[model samples]
Target chain A: MSVVLSIQGLTKAYKPGVPVLKGIDLDFDERGLTAIIGSSGTGKSTLVRIINRLVDPGDGTIVFKGEDLSRIHGRQLRELRRRIGMVFQEYNLVERLSVMENLLCGRLGYLSPLKAWLRRFPQEDIEHAYQLLDVIGLSNFANQRADSLSGGQRQRVGIARALMQRPELLLADEPTSSLDPKTSVEIMELLKSQGEDNKIPVLVNMHDVELAKRFADRIVGMTGGRVVFDGLPSRLTDDHLKLIYGGEGWLQ
Target chain B: MSSASIPAARPFESSLGAKLLALFILAYACYALGQLDFSWPRFVKGIDNGARFLDRMFPPSFKNWDQLLTGFIESMQIAVLATFFGVLISLPIAILGARNLMPSWATWPARLIVTLCRAFNPVIVAIIFIKAVGFGALAGVLALVMGSIGFVGKLFMEAIEEISMKQIEAIRATGAPFASVVAFGVLPQVMGRLVGFCTYQLDANLRNSTMVGIVGAGGIGGTLFAAFQRFEYDFVLAILITIIAVVLLGELLANYVKRIFNGES
Candidate 1:
């Protein structure tokens, strides 16, 4: 399989002395699901954010396709980001916008200001949005405001929005963290199927070990801002869990 | 638990400086009243003069109804036109003034423009505009536009600033252009409040537009001032009544506009 994304020596620090991501490296391939499992505050979300450049890195190199992400800025950065879809833990839908509008938000980068202000999206884009609505099983909620949707339904719209980008790589920053166990599994399944159907690599940050094991072909365990384990889920043992979670008591 | 286990209270004391300041203000008021010659005899005579003024203001004369209608209508036009122009201009100013969107250098200048517009009273601005434009309703409209920009623009900027950046980040991450980010991320959150502010500014301009005419900036106020100068107190009273009626109508119109855009309604 072709390498979809490559990261080398990625480091970020809000303050000079305390670093969040301290010299990290990663490589993602163009198929299946890869889950990043780690304890709370292990910089998992920051890693995904840096991949999308939502939060800029202090020092690093992210080569997605052939372009170096860290060196891009302005319109180039925007274009790169559009091709890489992202899903947030909180859904992050524009609450005031209608469900249909929220789904089409992914196309904003492709439309002109005049077209966006007038809400005159291309006909094909609108059709795809409607189709995605059915795909996500929320066809009846096209006109309803996003704030009126349940957490699960909103997250579904969130997924549809990311899919609207027709992304090469999908980055989900703890997408199931706000959901219940059943809902979390359902979302993971939805993500897994979407990745397979689209033939795109899905990188998910997760806390649930069993869910990750069930869905991920390979699991990357992170601890203290560095990758501690990178292998098939079958190889992630109790010893590896201890190293990733930083405690023996919680492993039980 | 024993009943006598309570702690003793501390004594409360007032500051001597506060008491002395109060006494000084009281003495100053008395001295100022004396200087103004506000005696019992003068007050009684002033009431007699007020009675004469009220008597002349009775049965408000509508003999100059044509002039009253024209002046009042002009004032209404000035107010509506000024408010429309002001709100149109303020949209961009508000965007520029948002701290999250613009750098400090840009926001500072945008804020300074709003502050300068707000610093002067509409009447004072009318006087200056009247001098610049050589009188008439044009000057009144211009003055009120400045007033509208200052008040409405500042309010719109603050509303924009208060929007959730999380929504903006989500939109930006989708690879939206800066303009698209504003339309999708920024505008939806602030749209309802912007409409409310625009309507409010319109109502305020309607009120100020009447007074701007007194400075020869053109409105019913010019005619009202002439009536006062000529001792036609009844005619002045008619203009005042008309202004009150127009202002009430404007308030009703503003509320209707707000309702139309509320979406919930």
Candidate 2:
């Protein structure tokens, strides 16, 4: 598979001496969902955010589609961002806006502020938003306010919003953490299926090891700001889990 | 655990300083009353004068009906124009002053401007505007606009700051421009509160519009002040009643607007 994004010598430190991501190097393929599994506070969220330039990196070269993402700013950065879609853990839909409007938010990069303010989204975008609502099985909820939706429904809208961008890359930051077990699986399934259907690479940060193993083609385990294991999920054994998470008490 | 060794429970803590302060306030008030020569005889005479004043104010005459109508129209015009311009100007200033949205360089100047606007009361501002604009409805409009900016700008900036950053982050991650981010992410969160602030400012401007006219800024207060100066007590009474009615009507309208914006039928 062709590599869609490559990270080289990535390092980040929030404080002067304390580093969150310590010299990370990885690449994402153009297809399949790859899950990064780790315990809390292991820089999983930071890694995901850094990829989208949400959190500035201390030092590194993030090469995506023949461009150095770390160096871009202003219009260039926005242009790069439009090509990448991120699903937040909180399903951060604008709560007071309708579901249809929230989905249209994904198209804000292409529309002028005046047009967006006037809510004059193009016909194609409106149609695509309607299609996405259907795909997420919320066709009847297009006019409903985002705050009124259930957590799972909101997450579905979040995913649909991301897909509205027709992004080349999809990044999810613990998209299932706030969800119940059953809903988590459903979200994962939707993410995987959507990724496959769109022909876009998916990089997901998750703590649920079983869900990751089940949905991901490949799993990368991280701990202490470094990747300790990278391989197919079938090959990720108890020993690897012990090394990545540390301690065996929770293994039982 | 003997009863003798157990400390008595003091649930209500009283401060000696508080009692001393209260005593000092009462003593100062009594001293001040004495200094002002506030005795029973003085109070009785004041009450007698007030009764005579009330008697003169009865049978309110609307003989100056044309003058009263013109003043009312002018005041309403001033209020509407002030609110319109105030809201228009405050939106950008509030956005600039929002620390979360703008850099420190932008917020500092914007905040300073808002503070300056709020530093003077509407009457004081009216005086300044009258000096500059030469005594008309324009002065009243300009003064109340400043008041509106001070009130709405500060509250709107606070409202912007209090919005959920997560929503903004999501929008930014979509690669949306700053304006689009504000349009979609920020505006929706604060729109309802903004409407509420605007309606309240309109209500305030309506009241202030009348007062600004007293300073030759051109509203009903000009006519009312003239009547008072001439001891046209009945005319003054009529103006006061009309003012009260107008204010009540403005309040009812403001509430209706607020309700509509709040999505209430």
Candidate 3:
């Protein structure tokens, strides 16, 4: 196994003294699904956001492919971002645009603004986008506006968009929080398979313990902005859940 | 649940200062009416003059159709050119003025430009342009362009500001360039409203183009104003009908644009 991403001494604060993420460290060794579980406001979302620099960390070194992500700027930063695909919880598809247009957003980094404005994405990219739409099971919805889709269908498009990036690592922040149980399971399965198919690590931050246990290859439990348990799913017992979530009442 | 309970204080309490303020406004309105000589007899006399003038205005004659056609065509040209250039220029300015996207320094200058454009009326701006450009449709177009920029630019900035940043963040996550972010993320969120605004601006510019001509800018208004001064009320009536026809046609075009852009009626 080889380390893909490594975070050292990660710390962040929205206010001067109130830290949302304390000093923490993490590493992804092989292509697998790793779920980070914590209760609301326990910094689960912040943890994933820091990886993509969506939310900057106050103090840390995020090393991806031997380069410190925090130190990069401009074109280098964009190149680094290209290697990491992030699926948002709210789907975030451009509502007014068609599904195909939104999916082509995955290739925005590669295309120039002039090309994008003229709808001149490479022929291969357009074909690949259509293929991804099929993979996400919305082949006929290519021209439909994003706002017309259901919650599950929209998330499917969201997944398709991220996959279009062909990233080295995929990050999903509470991707299932806005979905129903059946849809959540289906989305988790879709994400897990994409990680397997691409041979890239998938990092998911969620609060649904059962869903995580069912889908994740490994689970990292967090509490009070710090990792309290990191191991295989079978090893995450109720005691650890209590420690991570700080209550046994939720177990019932 | 607490319907029987009495509240500690009245809900719609009118402060004493508010009452006094209302009274003062009423008193000031009366004083303003007196200062303007807003008397009933004056209004009656004005109505008598208007009645006679209206009687003379019946049976419009288009005997001088060539001049009327030239002025009408010029006005339409001014309106179309102004809308095209104004929307083009204001689009970029509005994007720069969006505070959520750009730094304060960038936003401030763009906002200031838009503010200055909107501060003056089209007629006043037309007069200034007429002086600089020396009485032509160029002045009318320039004046209306500034008006369109001011009106549409502010609305566009507000539309950009109201968008979901999460959409932008998703695009940014793809490592897209800044221009691509705006093209893919920002523009889509506001394009519909922006298009609606552009159509509205075109309609407004059409109406204002005619008015600007009165100030020696250029348009049908110059012909109409000359007819008025020459006491050619019958010709004046002809020009008014043409203006009304042009305005109606412009309204139809605007509605068509709106429907096409939004894909709805």
Candidate 4:
């Protein structure tokens, strides 16, 4: 498989001298769901955010699609961001807007402010949004306000919004953490299927180990801002989990 | 529980300072009443004088209907124009003043402008505009516009500041430009409140439009002031009745516009 993104010596600190990500190095495949698992405050969310430049990195060299993502800014940075899609833990859809309008927000990078304000989206974009709605199983909820939807339905809309970008790389920051167990599995299935269908690599941060192991083609376990395990899901043994999570009591 | 061991129950502790302040206020009120020559006989005499004034205003006259109609129309025009222009100008200024949306430099200047606009009452603003623009509906419109800005701009800025930043971050993540981010994320959140502010401002401008004319800024207040000066109490009552009717109509119109814009039945 081709490498879609390569990270080398990536490090960041919200405060001086106290780094959150400590010289992390990893690679993402072109077209498989890679789940990163770790305990709380393990820098998983920070790692995901840094890939899209949502949270700035202190020292790093991130090469994605042949360009250095660490240095660019202004128009070039925005252009790069348009090619990368991100989903949030809270399903951060515009609550007051219609579901259809929220989906069209993914295309804002291409349209001018006046066009967006007037809601003059191109015909093709509208059709694509409708198709995505159908895929997400909310085709009839096009006119409904986003805030009126349930948690699972909102997450579906969030996934669809990310897909609307047609991004080469999809990054989900704890996409299913807020969901129940059953809904969590469903969301993971959807993410995995969508990634395979679009041939886009998905990098997901997750807390649930079993869900990650079941859905992820490859799993990377992290602790203390460092990856201690990187291999196929089948290779992640109980001892490895203990080392990554740093407790044997929870293993039982 | 032993009474001696338990601490004294002090659920409601009243402040000595508060009691003293209340006593001071009562003493000052009594002193001021005496100084102003307030007495039972004076109040009785004042009531008699008010009754005689009311007797003169019993029969309202609308003989000069043409002049009243012209002044009323002018007032309406001033109100509509002021509301439209004021809301238009306030939108951008409010956006700039929103601390969350803009830098401190931008917010400081925009907030300062709104403060200056709110510094004077609408009547005082009308007098200033009347001096600058000369006596006409234009002065009235300008004065009401300042009042509208002061009302809507500050409130709208606060509404913008209170929006969920998560929605904005999501839009920004899509690589949208700054303006597009605002158009999609920020405006949608605040549009409902903005409609309410605008309708309320329109209603206020309508009422102020009439009052500004009394200060020679234009509208029906000019005619009403003239009748008052000439001791035409009957004509004054007619003008007052007309003003009340127009203001009621304005309130109804404001509600209707608010309902339409807010999508509420």
Candidate 3 segments exceeding 4 Å error: B1-48, B260-265
The whole-model C-alpha lDDT of candidate 1 against the native structure comes to: 0.92
Candidate 2: what is its chain A TM-score? Answer: 0.99
lDDT of 2 by residue, B206-232 (tens): 999999999999999899999999999
TM-score of chain A, all candidates:
0.98, 0.99, 0.98, 0.99
Best by lDDT: 2
Error of 4 at B226 (Å): 1.5
lDDT of 3 by residue, A1-252 (tens): 899999998988999999988988999975999999998998989988888888877898999878898777789988888889999899999888899999999999888889988889999998999999888899999999999999999999999999899899999999999999999999999999999999999999998999999999999999888999999999999999999989798788
Per-residue lDDT of A50-87 in model 2, one digit per residue for the tens? Answer: 99899999898999988899978999999999999999
Candidate 1 residue lDDT tens string, B52-170: 99999998999999999899889889988999999999989989999999999889999999999999999999999988988999999999999999999999999999998888889
Against the true structure, whose DockQ is highest? 2
Predicted candidate 4 versus true structure: per-residue lDDT over A181-203, tens digit per residue: 99999899999999999999999
Docking class of 3: medium
Interface RMSD for each of the candidates: 0.7, 0.6, 0.8, 0.7
TM-score of each: 0.96, 0.95, 0.93, 0.93
Compare candidates 1 and 4 on DockQ and give the better one.
1
Scored by CA lDDT, what does every candidate get?
A: 0.92, 0.94, 0.92, 0.91
Chain B TM-score for all candidates, comma-separated: 0.92, 0.93, 0.89, 0.91
Sliding window of 10 residues with minimal summed lDDT for model 4 chain A: A51-60
Q: What's the TM for model 4? A: 0.93
Per-residue lDDT tens digits for candidate 4, residues B90-171, read 9999999999889999999999999999999999999998889898999999999999899999999999999999999899
Residue pairs whose backbone atoms clash in candidate 1: none
